[model samples]
Target chain A: EPEVTQTPSHQVTQMGQEVILRCVPISNHLYFYWYRQILGQKVEFLVSFYNNEISEKSEIFDDQFSVERPDGSNFTLKIRSTKLEDSAMYFCASSEAQLEAFFGQGTRLTVV
Target chain B: AQSVAQPEDQVNVAEGNPLTVKCTYSVSGNPYLFWYVQYPNRGLQFLLKYITGDNLVKGSYGFEAEFNKSQTSFHLKKPSALVSDSALYFCAVRDMQRGNKLVFGAGTILRVKS
Candidate 1:
């Protein structure tokens, strides 16, 4: 079965440095999303993208966060300055019509 | 706003015994409920969902969930638990007429022991 793929399974970045997480959703998927789960915490929604633009975002998706669908296959989440609290597992998901979604393995980000 | 609540932090059941993980949801309009499972160091895997029609929804791995509109809940159940079923499970909800983002509950850790 086709799966969502994320790059840089793990990342270590210095505090206040910029970081970008990349994901390649299923080819035929029309809706994409980004969610984060702090260690031992619930999964929190970040943002949703459709038609190459942001459709909706949660309060957790603040000014420092940005998402882009630069190409037909690549979707990216960029953080201008990493904070210690930002350390978590970031997941990328995609859905064909919003009924069921498939999530990527996730990218573990560590900020020090 | 839409949200899901999983009351139990962990549920322990012997192998071959029945198991149920409770889930309650709050959503405006019609609720689209879902169940997902996660293995160690893995992403969330879709198990089943309740959009409409029958209240009983069957999913992968012999798992099923019943959607109760009156109680605003969708609970996952399994007839006979297995050791392999030991994992973290999550309940999520979305409004059918609303957007695509899904609100997930904290999670329930199910341990099927032998």
Candidate 2:
């Protein structure tokens, strides 16, 4: 089966540095989403993108964060500046209209 | 708002015994419920979902869930358990009225021992 793919399975970055997490959603999917899970916490929604614009975002998705579908296939999440609390497992998901979303293995971001 | 509750933090069962992971949800409109399993160090795997269907929905790996509209529950079950089934299970719900984001439960750890 086709799967969502994320690059850099794990990342370690300095506290103030910028970080970009890359994901390639299933080729035919139209809706794309980003979610994060702090260790031992529930997964939290970050943002959803469709048609090259953000459809909706949670309060947790603040000014410092942005998402881009730079090309047809690659979706990227960029954090302007990282904070310690930003460390978590970030997941990328995609789906066709009104179906279950498939997830990627996730990018584990670690900030020090 | 839309929310999902997985009441148990963890459930332990012996091999060959039936296993259940309970899930209850609240949504203003009809719900789109889903169950996902996470093996250690891996991504969430789709288990099953309840859309507009019969109450009983069968999914991957010999697992099934019964959606109770009156009680607002969608619980995962397997007639018999296996050690390989041990993993973290999450219940999630999508309220189309609220946009397309999913709200996930805290997750329940299922441990099936030999």
Best by DockQ: 2
Best by lDDT: 2
| Candidate 1: stretches off by over 4 Å | B96-98
TM-score of chain A of each: 0.97, 0.98
Model 2 spans > 4 angstroms off: none
Candidate 1, residues A20-88: lDDT per residue as tens digits?
Answer: 999999999999999999874688889988888888888889999999998789999999899999999
Q: Which candidate achieves the best TM-score against the true structure?
A: 2
After superposition of all CA atoms, the RMSD between model 2 and the true structure is 0.9
- lDDT digits (tens) for residues A12-99 of candidate 2: 9999999999999999999999999888468899998888899889999999999999989999999878999999999999988567
B30 Cα displacement, candidate 1 (Å): 1.3
CA shift of A6, model 2, Å:
0.2
